[model samples]
Target: MNQDEDAAPVEMLASLCEARGWQYEFVGDDELTTEIQGSWATYQLRAVWRSEDHVLQLICLPDIRVPDDKKAQMYEVLALVNEQLWLGHFDVWSNGMVLLYRHAMMLGDDGLLSVAQAQSAIETAVEECDRFYPAFQFILWGDKSPADALASALVDAAGEA
Candidate 1:
């Protein structure tokens, strides 16, 4: 196939998800939603194929609700985590409760996103979301500083091994 040829269609992405044993539903012609089970919580992942813009977007929403008082701390921790991430970044809703991790692929320049690329994007979102979830919990419930929460979250990973 020509390198500039359009990548696989949305249907192919759905098939890939199914083959991987993921439960998903099509939200629209260009969007698919799947639920991923994480160590701490179940995450809702949504993939959108923007054919016009030639981008594939992946977003993961963890089962977390940041309290009003913790919004600032949550943003601080998110900033720290975002800095460490190679792809995707954490974002908070204006309501200060909803948190989501988002990543995008420019299909126009990169060509169609292969199955591996799609899977990698999904995995990366879930992995990063799982890693930083506890930090948000700490900030919202434990009242820990952003730095402290992040440190504790990272240290906790070491203990998991």
Candidate 2:
């Protein structure tokens, strides 16, 4: 796929969300950027989005020169998240490997449980993982396991928030 081309699954998801009255927007571009966390450091935070109750995000880097198999694994991890979780009421935020899970726990503009909250929950999740583990490694070598690990991490982080 072209660095600028979004995966087909994401496009389909976006269409589905739109059909359901949710707005799907993609953010960011194919610009080279530094990986603030992880070995094999340096990547691009390619895209982001807002769904009805979730924040959608994508990042792709054709550089940093990792093995192709590893990159495919990382892509799988992202695909799994979008398929199983992101299409729901759970609000999400992401910048590539760093996915922030929040919402449903905050006070609304009217002081009730708001649909949006401080981004700390998601931020802390990514920070904690980045501090203790290697994001690039996960993406490079993380097969199906990475998906599970990420899902657990997000759930734990949201609970903390």
Candidate 3:
């Protein structure tokens, strides 16, 4: 793990999930899936360990769904929500029906994932998804403007301290 080499970071994530008592199951040799219950909603999180690139991607799909009639507003909300985050940005899936938050951690030359690295990626996904669930909801169902939705959610972009 000292440099670019075969890495089993997905195993590391499994260990983390087990240690935290969060139920998760392996998808394959390189990926895993789990649900993280957040304050706003429970989210499905998938972690894919990209061996060649030495990266682990955590994609979090919240319970929010964008109806066809609300796609315009949802697009606006996507802009507002993504601009307010440091770790990840929100995006709609190819189906154009589901919204997801995506964040990635580069394992660097070592291709190793530390506990903090794994924890950060997982926490970032859940936290961002939870934080903006209401904003998406406001846009999708409440007939609220993106600005109003973000304002109501008290969301502002994070800057480094």
User: Top model by TM-score, which number?
Assistant: 1
lDDT, candidate 2, equals: 0.36
- The residue ranges of model 2 lying beyond 4 angstroms of the native Cα positions read 1-67, 84-137, 141-144
Supply the TM-score for candidate 3.
Answer: 0.88
User: Model 3, which residues run further than 4 Å from truth?
Assistant: 1-7, 155-161
Clashes of 1: 1
Cα deviation of 54, candidate 2, in Å:
24
Per-candidate Cα RMSD to the true structure, in Å, reads 3.2, 14.3, 4.4
For model 1, how does the per-residue alpha-carbon lDDT over 1-161 read when each residue is reduced to its tens digit? 33333456566567767777988899988888989888889999888888878888888999677777777888899999888889989998776468999988887554467666666787888889888888888898888999999999989977886
Candidate 2 at 45: error in angstroms? 7.2
Please give each candidate's TM-score: 0.89, 0.27, 0.88
Between candidates 1 and 2, the lDDT winner: 1
lDDT of candidates 1 onward, in order: 0.81, 0.36, 0.81
Q: What is the lDDT of residue 131 in candidate 2?
A: 31
Top-down lDDT ranking: 1, 3, 2
